[model samples]
Target: MRTEANRRKINRLYILGAGASYALTQGQTESLVAPLDIQFCQRIKDLQQRTRPKWVAAAARRVEKEYLHHVDFQITGLEELIRQQISDYEFIAAIHPRRTRGKRTKEEYLNDLNHLAAYLLSRARARDQSLLEKWLEKYLKGTEKRATRNRIITFNYDTLIDNVLLNWHSPQHVYFDNIWSSSTKSPTRLADRYPLLLKLHGSINWRCSEEEYAKLFNSAVTTDESKTTTYNTKDCHYIDKMWINNRVCTPEEQETPLIIPPLPQKPITSIAIFRYLWTYAYEYLYEARNIVIAGYSLPPEPPRVSRRLQLLREWSHEQVKQVFT
Candidate 1:
């Protein structure tokens, strides 16, 4: 049992989705939603056309014209088509250094995905306008400076709620204990007085490697590197920064976006941090007193995700009480 649960009742647990962020847009406009999910193709196509570093714009356009040609722009069921394209070896062989002999260069696929990740990072201004906004406003007025516990589990790669919780709580208190480890379980207890936000799909602003990044970006990015934070894992050195500040980083300054794209089986889910996140999400689900889902439908396109999350189907059978969709 979570130690705090024994002493103080855990407050409502919120599960957020793209809809939550969509609700945060300047006017809650569809066009202003962060660039992921159904909007990915259109947003990436638009971004490629106008984004900076003329070479990147040209490269993105070329890749879309050639590889992504099959999907209709802005269509509702495009994810089915997207899954096909993502699995195509002909276009994305560039992701593998030795498999570089295809229609697209090794750099194009990587550039496009990172470009999309950077786009999401630029929209971090979102979390403060939704339920989180209301919750924090109410939280600050309460007498419980310590002891009360609340939590949010979000699938969004954007740092909207993550940033909000960070402002009100120490960063360490917001995660599973030792979250970087793949095998970690819940801590018997966590810190008090603030909500913890679990980002299941990973964040665009999460830690990435400096050495790997150097291969993609020009040395010029190093000038601002000193302002960033770095730490060593069991294996390599990583810096807690993604691309530099921009909707689309210039080709020379491009650093890959760290967010996981929605593939049936994400190539990176094997990494420990993400596994640890999902494990915690499962624990929090059973522990919460109340659960509310916002802007998430648990789409079935990513077959592996749907299969792993078969437990969600139990909700329809009333396994958990008071679920608000």
Candidate 2:
């Protein structure tokens, strides 16, 4: 709950990342560790060692300097065996240093990435819904002034925010679409009065469809009603169904495009749902006055997001306030 004065202030925007929700969800600090890509690189080096590749030795040394010192320096530190497979002497060194000798296979590496991604996202989603539900109750119950004029803009692709707001009986209140046409001015329609949640990168629950928006709305609402899991708490269930057909495929099975990765790419094929989301993210930024950012690293877009954030910073002049809180 906010103070009466703060509640009366202008609409606020919230930017969240894995860390933000991870904190609320009781995620361990070690869970937030990086060196994720390095996990894959190490595996590559291990495989190269057995069947000496042209670049194995050099790559191993470079990887050691780049990352191994902090984690595994013993094998990498071996003056002559840096590129060698598990020689008898090197094997002794590996055991002494408590480092695994074989690098994980490609498939194994992919599984590791997926496991990390899933754990991080699970923690984030759980926390995201908890916070959003608190604010949403305020909006629905008309508890505060700021709650009446609030919207959320996040880089996450999780369905936590979507499920909470829609469950609050105001699906129209949350705006997920991105309208790109310059001529299309912002509408002061009934939905505009409701709180908006623009997921900039995209979300797993949403799909590109040829179906009418009305049908989609009805279907979503129906699904919302069917979900018996509680929201806004660690006890809440994970909405794995949100992902394309409830699919959490391995790297090889991830043939279709994705929106939840560390980076995002424009789908060459037409994905109407994604187009709508990307458009609305821009719109949310355009209309926002105060943006609250938390744990998000602003990545550059060709002519959007990053540049817009830069311009916002330059022109803010105390007009817009970005707080990590």
Candidate 3:
């Protein structure tokens, strides 16, 4: 039996950033994956060395020709250069006529960029003794002691947090846009459950129909076993393996994993799933009493993300009792 006082306690919201994922490396040089902004050229070069895909090679050449030609290496990183290219391409597309030949379109560039990012992130294997799991346990224990309600909002696309939560509790407890239930039972909305986890930037494991993207955002639960899809990061690895083995041959097979790349201006409002995530995040931030920001620098370059964070800070300023950064 729960007490009335417990139900009335303040909610705690945690904000995670790229640095949060990087910190999980625990100073291990071999297992560490470089952040978006660091080692921009080297990452591309390494990817080129690993794979012989024409698109990957073409993407590298484009990056070198367009960005590395004149920019100061000390000042701008890969992420910044990529953002600038995307922005410039967008501007050109909006004003001038679409060019069919000589250069790759903005969409093609973005596709290559996303594929490269996914490949890089997927290669990062967790160590035998996980430090992330231990850290999360202690963090959760402390948060539960002070707050009645707790939720996580992560900007990073990695599945480290997802792995921790799923391992800690039942699959139903960890909600990413979709709900989960046993094969015998119907799924339920994440809001119906306590302690929700929202991925703001999306995840590597998430995939949906490119043609029917909005359909993927539907919250209606399914009871039919055939229709019920298992939401696990490992499932993503399986899909990747199938693709590599030539088992995935059809167009539908190739476009299964739908991931949103790390860009300055994300199409959150345009996409149904992202829009819902942002709305959910805003609601939580507005009602939260404590906001714990860990390892997130809140970079000023990304307008969409920065604007939302600014609004969250403003909305929770009066109600928030404490802010831990």
Candidate 4:
């Protein structure tokens, strides 16, 4: 049994999923109802419709005919096909030699599926960042206990939480994500010891350039678009650039970093940077006294991640207390 002292002395953390914010607004949830798989299948159809170089078209047609069609060729079907291709390619081949291609490699199919999934999920309804701000305000207010420290770990690409933490540029709200900072100063040791936000899956507002990438595995923000963004060893650097920097105050310049278009495709492996961040977040969760799970279904597709958390739960003896502690 966990002693009251142990639980009371622990830290507090929250794990959020894309669904968490969406849940706050039914309208937002409805907007995300467009299944990613369906959209991806449509994209493939769109690609087939568009006039491409003869070589490109031919390769696509070959992939579609030999690979896509065999998997029932529906948007919903792509995920399973990708999974099977990776873990059971040989078994799949025995079932259908023509589609599998005698020399077909599972990794290639998996890659295709990843790109497809990323595109599809990208289409999920735009979350109401405003609503998120409200919820966060309430949550944070309830979290004012002096002895308790609070932090958040999120896998989402949205910035609703970012806006809330920074208090709409209000001086009162001094919190920062530090995901995109280019500061040369040593990292704040307080960040290491205190509860701090960790973008385990990366955020949408982060940006970087090639130079920053070379100097630091990743740096947070840079004035130079070509300069690489900084990243801590904890996250994968593969997240989308959050916001573009525009020195020009003109409206045209402000619109340069429009969010990437959503197209149905396979899942992109999170940047290795995300992997590290995620691992750290998990460690924090196990140690934290309170945990609030929001907006995630805990999919089994990513077995490693779910497994890690499960192991933590077991190790904690299911004795982890809630944040109210």
Predicted structure with the largest TM-score when compared to the true one: 3
- lDDT tens digits, residues 43-146, model 3? 76555544444555655555555542256533566567667777777666667646424676655555555555555555454553366667566655343334
Instruction: Candidate 1: list runs displaced more than 4 Å.
Output: 1-9, 26-31, 49-59, 66-69, 73-82, 90-111, 124-132, 139-145, 175-195, 210-255, 267-269, 300-308, 311-321
Candidate 2 per-residue lDDT over residues 149-211, each given as its tens digit: 556666555555566665553433454212211112332234233236656555544322222
Clashes of each: 0, 4, 1, 42
Top candidate by lDDT: 3
* Per-residue lDDT over 71-141 for candidate 4, one digit per residue giving the tens place of the 0 to 100 score: 55545344454444444556666787786656646443433333333333444443565665676565553
Please give the distance, in angstroms, between residue 157's alpha carbon in candidate 4 and its true position after superposition. 3.7
Give the local distance difference test score of model 2.
0.40
* Shift in Å, residue 44, candidate 3: 2.3
Cα deviation in Å at residue 43, candidate 4?
A: 8.3
The 0-to-1 C-alpha lDDT of every candidate, in the order given, reads 0.51, 0.40, 0.53, 0.42
TM-score of model 4 vs. true structure: 0.49
Question: lDDT-based ranking, best first?
Answer: 3, 1, 4, 2
Point out where model 4 deviates above 4 Å.
Answer: 1-11, 21-69, 75-81, 85-130, 140-148, 166-178, 181-196, 204-272, 298-319, 323-325
The residue ranges of model 3 lying beyond 4 angstroms of the native Cα positions read 1-10, 51-78, 90-102, 125-129, 138-148, 170-172, 177-195, 212-253, 262-264, 300-305
Clashing pairs in 2: 7-146, 178-276, 178-279, 178-280
User: Which portions of model 2 show Cα errors greater than 4 Å?
Assistant: 1-10, 27-132, 139-147, 170-195, 208-260, 263-278, 297-325
Best-to-worst order by TM-score is 3, 1, 4, 2
